[model samples]
Target: MSPGGKSAKSSSPSPPANYSAAGEEFIGVDDFNEDAHTPESKTGSAYLEIHSRQNNAILKKNQEESIETINYLEIQSFELLNT
Candidate 1:
């Protein structure tokens, strides 16, 4: 028996390969309506922005704290060496 359980000379038709391309256009808030005012929508948008800002601040604080800890360790090592 061959590797595929058939003779090596057995001919089999191969299927054609397929390909596709797709994309989408993003629409901003200003593109939707002229006067469809709603308080909830505005509040939600503002809340998201505030949340993003807070997250960025927390990340920055953590990074600064890490640097400070590393500096403190270096100073203590230097003091130990002098003694």
Candidate 2:
């Protein structure tokens, strides 16, 4: 170390400073597409085909269960004298 102590060197580049204002048109929310944010699945066709079949089966099972539950509720509601 030198008797007069100072940092040897700096190697970082300085960033440029700039700011500007510009005018542009603004549109209402009605113009926006709802699907813009949801990215489409990129899975290949074969994988999607297998997944679709599995999902269809699961959906049918769930739908059947839902209808059964609804039927039970409807019967229970019919038995209730007080609203």
Candidate 3:
């Protein structure tokens, strides 16, 4: 083996960035709506920003779970070989 060690032969495909948890795609609008007066009625980019944050949160959770699962499997494999 080289000093850098061996790299894996297979890699998992990355999740799509545009997809949401509920499979909803964001369609943004061009208008900022200056005459709306109040902020509650006119949501120019809030929805998109919130949805993007939600997607990021879910992805972080999944990544954490994947690490835990990988560690568990490695321990089980070692036990099996020892037995």
Measured by lDDT, the strongest candidate is 3
lDDT per residue for candidate 1 within 2-67, as digits (tens), equals: 798877764654322221112232234343222432223565467557878999999999999999
Ranking by lDDT: 3, 1, 2
Q: Give the TM-score of candidate 3.
A: 0.48
TM-score of each: 0.42, 0.44, 0.48
CA RMSD for every model? 17.5, 17.1, 24.0
Clashing pairs for model 1 are none
Query: Worst 10-residue stretch by lDDT in candidate 1?
Result: 16-25
Q: List the residue pairs that clash in candidate 3.
A: none
lDDT of 3 by residue, 1-83 (tens): 44579765546553334333355543432333333322233564565567779999999999999999999999999999999
Scored by Cα lDDT, where does model 3 land? 0.60
Best by TM-score: 3
Residue pairs with clashing backbones, model 2? none
Pick out the ten consecutive residues of candidate 2 with the lowest summed lDDT: 15-24
